[model samples]
Target: MLEIVLMHPDGKLQRLEAPVGVSLMQVATGAGVRSIVAECGGSAMCATCHVYVDPAWAGKLAPPLANELEMLECTSSERRPTSRLSCQIKLRADLDGLTVQLPESQQ
Candidate 1:
């Protein structure tokens, strides 16, 4: 299992375990992390699963593909340099202990 850390807008933190080959959105939604709406179901069509990758870990992740970059423009929250669509982040051994901050809203 891979571990992920989520920092909520309210300052609460949640640590979740995810199996390899699953997206961050899948782990959050399955764990009832309300901040990750994931309306597009990992298709990267909706930006509801937006999250802010911890700057320290940003370099470890793959750059967002063109499609994901396009969808990011539709996010309900302010997009930052480290912003990412959780559905596009696949879990892997090297990604264990990854940290992300949930946007204030997903709607």
Candidate 2:
């Protein structure tokens, strides 16, 4: 299982244990975390699942692909160097302690 820590802007933190290989958006939605809209499921077609990857684990995951990059450009929130689309991030055993911060808004 991969353990993920998701933090909300209001200082709330949620810890979830998800099986490896699923997308981060899937795990967050399954846990009832509403920050990520995941409008297109895991298709990488929407940026509603945007999150900021913790700098500590940024290098552990794959760089964004062209599709994901394009989608992220549509997010309503300001993008940061660590910004990423949760749907494009797949969980792995090596990402057991992955941490991501939910953006202020997805509307």
Winning model by lDDT: 1
Q: Which regions of candidate 2 are displaced past 4 Å? A: none
Q: List TM-scores for all candidates, in order.
A: 0.97, 0.97
The lDDT per prediction is: 0.93, 0.92
Task: Encode model 1's per-residue lDDT on 43-80: one tens digit a residue.
Answer: 99989999999999999998999999999999999999
Error of 2 at 58 (Å): 0.8
Residue-by-residue lDDT tens digits, candidate 2, 36-57: 9998888988899999999999
Worst 10 residues of 1 by lDDT: 33-42
Q: Report the C-alpha displacement of residue 82, candidate 1, in angstroms.
A: 0.4
State the local distance difference test value for candidate 2: 0.92
